[model samples]
Structures are given as C-alpha cells and as structure tokens.
Target: MTEAALTISHLSIHDRSGAALVDDVSLSVPRGGVLTLIGETGSGKSLIAQAVFGLLPAGLSVSGTITIGGHESIPASEPKRLAALWREQIMLIPQEPSAALDPTMRVKRQMALAGLQEEAIKPALAAFDLPGSTADAYPFTLSGGMAQRVLVASALGVGAPIIVADEPTKGLDSDRVTQAIAALKRLSAAGRSLLVITHDRRLAEELPGELAIIRNGRVVEHGPSAGLLSAPQSDYARTWLAADPRHWPRCHRCCDMTSLALSAHGLSFGWPKGGMLFEDLDLHLPKGGVLAISGPSGSGKSTLGDILLGLRRPMAGSVEWGGLDIVAMPSAIPPLRQRYQKLHQDPITAFVPHLTFARQFLALEDVKSGLSAARDLPPLLERLKVNHRLMNRRPCEVSGGEAQRLALARILLLDPVAIVADEPTSRLDPVVQRETMQLLRATVDQQGLGLVLISHDQPLLAAIADEHLALGPRA
Candidate 1:
C-alpha cells in the first residue's frame, strides 16, 4: 500500500466575478507515486496547485483544506514556511517556465539557488540535453529550448520530494520531452511524489500511476491510466480524448477552394545589420485558403509572419498583397492593422494579464468604434465555437484553450484580407488543434480572408492546409 503524501477535500476557488473557478474538487497523492492532474484551461487544475502550495494571485480566494505531508494547515501566510517548503520538500516546475525562470541570472546560479552546487550543475545540464557549459550563461542568452531545460534542471536539482509540474514541457522538443518524462518516472521510483499538471493525455497515460480528470474544478473521473484512456467512462473524459491529436481528422473540403489572396515577387528579405533570415524567398496564399508554414522551432517562420504583417521592413525584395506591393502602398498600411491580424504562439503572455476580457475587448473597440465592432461577437463566437457566455471573463479566469480561441476571435473581428497566425495549435491538444484550424479555415472562407499559419507541428498542418512550405527548405 502507498503512503499518502498530499490530500485535499471539497476544494473550491472563485474568481473576481464570484464565479467558482474550481467548484468542488478533491484528490490525494501517495508518497512516492506520480498523480497527474489533467484538464482543459480554466478547469481549476492550476488553482488546485496554487491552493495546495498557497500561490494564487492577489484578490482571489480559496476554500477547503489542502493538507501536505499530513499537516492540515499549509501555513501559506508564512513566507519562510513557503520558501522552505519550496526549496526542501515541494516545488513547482511552473506552467510558464520562461516567466518562472529569471532571465538575468546565469543558469548555474539559478540551479544553485535550488540547492545544487556549481560542480553538480554539469550533470544536471547533461541530464536535460543542455551543454555542460550552460551554467555560465544567463537565461535570456539561451535559446527557448535551452531555457526550458534549465527550468526543469533547476527544479530537479533541488531534490524536492513533491513536485507540481505545470506544463513543464511548454518549450521543449519531443526528445527533451521524453527525457523530462523519464526523469519524473525516476523521481517517483525513488520515493518522491509528483503531481504532473498537463492537458496532454498522452503524457498522462505514460506516467506509472493514476490519472485524475478535473473539469470546471471537480474530479470528474479517476482510475487506472490504461483502462481510463482505453475506455473512458465519463463524457468529459471522452470529449478530452476525442480532442486528442490521435483522433483528429484533416480538413478535406478546404482543398477545393483557392484563389491567390497574397503573393510575393522575388521576395528577398534580410536584416540590414545582417542576418539573412529569408533571402530571395517567395510564397503565396490563395483567397480563402490555408497555407501552413512548417519547420522545427526557431527556424525564422515567425520572422516571416511579422514581415507579411508589415511590422518589419525587409532589406531586399517585395511582398505583393492582391498583386500590389504592400510595402510601396503606404496608403493601405493604416487599415491593414485591422485587415491583417496575428495570434502569437503563447496566449497567456500575449494578453495583458491584469485586464478583464471585457476591458481588453473595449480597448480593441476603442481602435475601431461603434456597433459594427459589436457585429463581430456572434458569428465570430459561433464560428470559433467558444462559449459566448465567457466573453466577460478575464483572460486569467479562462482556460488556455479558451484564451487561444479568444485571441483567434480578436483576429477574426479585424476581418483582415489576410490572416497570419504563428503556431495556432502549438499549445493545444490534438483534437483542439484540428477543430481550431477548421474554424480558422471556415472563418477565412466565409469572409474571403487569406490565411498563413506558421508552425513546427506537422499533423496540424496536414489537417487544414492547402499547401505546405518549410522555411529553410521552402520553395
């Protein structure tokens, strides 16, 4: 029999709107076992973590007891207790690793703060595919992938007995993701407890223990991993599984329609300070068509997306929008901000954190006034299929998928002649990814908007795109 390490009962959390973010939730973690908390964003999974560790933001309130290590009171009000708890026994591999990790400090210095000695830092880096020499480099100086490994490495070095990993692999590649997962298994095997918080069912399935599905703040289902995944008993579980990437279907209808909405002529673009990110490059997106720009991470796809939006000027070559050089037509540039929109890779950081959804929408409204802006909500929400009910909720109050959908909706509202999206599916699970692309495609078709999707994820592209182009090998 396993020993209980963490316990919760009748846990509930509410946002400023007084809506229960986590309705009634309860679960337990055995000492030396791994328990994954899986749920969509705004489903109260993160709140549970915050409640357990006492880390919720200001003004938010939580109820019910979160007992850790048999103590009824977590003593979260005591910083010394929280800090000590963090360094010695429990830790969080935070959801946003980049944000959690300080960009100023050197990797080795950060690792030392987590309890590892400088001499031991090399081994830690090696464990996560980081160079042994990375200890000397600052966090911002490292690549996104490198930064992620450091985040995990710092937490692991602390020798925390219980860890709450929230989307720990946000910036990691597949190989590093595997390594991180294996490391978690090793921790569990060694008598440390872990609660992996993620939306990825596949990762949840691979852990050597139980799966608990939480939705709208309740434990909707709990059972052995294999059985629950193979034959889910709950509707929420089934919906989640259906949304998994493995079950997603590609859009076949989108292929029949294509009418060139944007094209490039001898497009040679480079940095004046001189890095030829793209040189003598050419690509096109048909009217109402979905064109996916695919490649590995950091391959300059986002750079090209920014260029297309006229946010950056190219040193050479030309980009033709409707057969006219948009660079030369300074006249159309003003309206283009509304006509050409972009949804960045990360949704949470992309939004103004403190603003409520209504406030953010109002700011957008301030850009282009009147009732016509209100015209965007219904069809936009219906097409995107986001709950129109969630319109008033703050960005922090909503789920990750919901936030992504909202970001997409804002782009749709602008009704640009061309839409340039950067990795719209990277943060989403398989099912959501496919559904989102379909919605994006449908929006483009109905409005005759051009779509250019930038991503390193292939399966998503295979599902919705009319044409595929890789950056370095692009034609």
Candidate 2:
C-alpha cells in the first residue's frame, strides 16, 4: 500500500473538565487524495481539523498521533514541531475568511505574505475570479464571498503539500463555489492531500473522495463519497444528506401587498471612493412578508440591506416604515432604530466575546425601553429551541448555529417591527439552516414582522422567500 500523506490515529479531544469532544476518531488521506468531513454544527469536525493543525484553544486537551509527510508527533505535546509545518507543508483555509485575513493589509500584500511571489499575485486573484482591482482593496472593503475567495486563492497559492480547508465555500455564491471547487481539484491534481470540512452538500457531491460522517464527536460512517452519498449505511448520515436545502419543500407563502411594513424608493448608494452599487432601486415588504435578495459577490445585496436598516445613508432615497419616512427623520432615530434590527452573517461578531448571553440580555433590557417588561429570556430560548444553559456561556464557547439562534433571541427582545437578516445561516449546517429559516418564517407569521433576507443560497430563497430581488453588477 502507498504511504498516506496524512494520518490521524486514535485521536481524542477533551474539554477542560475532561469531557470528550472528539472520541477515538481515526482517518487518513492518501497522497493527492481528498477526505471530506460532513456533520451537523458542533459535531467536532472542525475540532479534528484544529487538532491536526495545533489550533485548538488552550483549555482543551488532545490525545492523538498526527503523522504528516512521514513525521509523527503527538499534537498535545509537540506544539512547536506542528507549528513549524505551517505554510511549507500544510495550510489551513479557515472557515471565517474575514477573521483569517488581516484588516490592515491589502489583498495583494496578504497574498505575498502567504508565500506568493510579487508577480504571481494578480494571476492568483484572477484564478479565483477576483479582478485585478481586488488585489489593492482592503479586507474590510470586500464582501464575505470576496474575502473567502481571497483566502482560498492565497492559501492554495502557497503550494502546501497538505491543505486543511474548513467550510471553504462558506460565504460564496453558487458560481464562486464552482470556482473554489475547481481550485481545490487543481491542488489535488497536483498531488496534494486535502482534508475538507464543510456543510455544503454540493461540494461533497462534486468532490470525489473518502467521506466521513461525524456526529457528536464520533465518526459514525466512513466510505467512498459516491457510495455513501448514494447509499449511506448510517441513520445520521442519511438524515444529514436529506437535510440539504435542495431537498427542502418549496414554500408557497403568498405576499400581502396592502400593508407595507417597510419600503424603499429611488434608493441610490455607493462609497465615496467607489462607483455606484445600485441606482434608482425600489423595494417593498408587507407585514409578515419575506423579501429575499440574491446576487453575485460584491453586487450590493448586503449594502441594500444596510440602506434599508439605516446603517448606511443612501446618496438619494427614502426608507419608510409604517407609512413614515424613517430615513428622513434623523431626530426619531433613537426610538425608530429599535424597530428595525439586523441579524449579522457572523453572529459571533454581533455579540461581545467575553460577555455571557445572560448578561448581554440584562444589558439590553437596561437600555431598550419596555424590553424588560415585554419578554423574558426563557420563553424566547424555548421558542428558538436553544438550551438555557447556553445563556451562561460566552459567545465564543458556543457553536455558530447556537450563537446565531441566541442572536435572534436577543433581537426578539427588542420587539422589532422588521429584521434585515444578512446571510444569517451561511455558516450553519443543513439541518440547522433549515431550523433557523423555519424559526424566522414563524416569527414573520406570528408577529407580523417584515424580513429582508440577503443570501446566496438559491434553494433556501426558493424555500422561504415571499418575494425575490436579483441584484446585478454596479451601474
């Protein structure tokens, strides 16, 4: 048998209290082969990747043998040795592209720092469908999908022997996802081993490799991707596969056009240094309705949401709520702002990392009028199907799905009339994504709340949106 490029033997990870997070997991990736890990949120798939790269948090304890390129070491004991392997032998395309990039540096400089030669930066960006102008842009100026492509381009450009990509297509639209898959395939074709962790079923189906279905820290099933995806042996694996957004039943909700909750007229917005994103755009959302926006990366989907929510001033337009133009009323901003809320793509950023959710809720009650008298946390938690125990933990201690649900709960406390959800489930697993959308739909139905959902997932939009708006490139 040919030697494997990477191997994990009897790997187990435990939290500070000795409770196992990953239990006796073993896997291998042959030279030039791919090993894809599919599981629900908090399933320990990313934890295994972190252990291999020695990126696990300080309190966690690891017991495992990770062999990379014929060199063996215990991840728990040999921190420096594993650190030495980064970039040259292995590179991680992290799940959170925004966090992975440096805010201060330009994209071209970051690529150069990732071991790409100065001359190679433009072609590398172009390979990921990023324009030459993207090379000079800062990370913060890029959209979530744009940042994801930048990270993928830079990471793959390094020519590492082993690449561990966690949710590499997290924020990309369908077309960019295809581009990313092509890049990964090229790396594999070049004889580099890959360990891809993702919740994207399309990626799993397209990338031919060994598949491992992880659940609650255990690898419940492992086989060839084609065989397992076609005929999975385990029940959990079956459920996971069935939860893809593509398999979801389409929503038949009809839009109610009479009572407008929010409306935008002749909206035009663009950055001072940039060209117009959209001009003379109009939108309408009735009470208890969903208005979904979709487009290519950097096509102003999120920007339009920001304008409606009053986060950004449109060069020319008015946003009206309840028949009143809120955009023109700067003095009413204090109370009016509470009526419109936003659920961010990354919920972790919406929360304070060090503060517990319970404390944050209390803080919100203190500031927001009538919030304390309106609702309690327990009922909201129950409604969202979140565990009460999670309220005691900080945002960083919970999974992305849990944090997002909690963010929703926080927004609910404000008793908002409308919500602008910007890819709220982009990072979530399929099952959790479905659940979150269901909850959002329920909220819209039950409370007569308007929702402006910005997303790249077509199936999800087809499943829940009452109205669809497709944005194009800036005029």
lDDT of 2 by residue, 102-127 (tens): 99999898888889998888898998
User: Which 10-residue window of candidate 2 scores lowest in summed lDDT?
Assistant: 366-375
Task: Count clashing residue pairs per candidate.
Answer: 6, 0
User: TM-score for every candidate vs. truth?
Assistant: 0.85, 0.95
Alpha carbon lDDT at 245, candidate 2: 78
Candidate 2 lDDT score at position 145: 90
* Candidate 1 lDDT by residue in tens digits, 279-354: 7777877777788886543346767787787777666667766566877775666765676777876676677887
* Candidate 1 lDDT score at position 148: 66
lDDT assessment of candidate 2: 0.86
What is the clash tally of candidate 1? 6
Per-candidate RMSD, Å: 3.7, 2.0
Evaluated at residue 362, the lDDT of candidate 2 is: 88
RMSD of 2: 2.0
Best by lDDT: 2
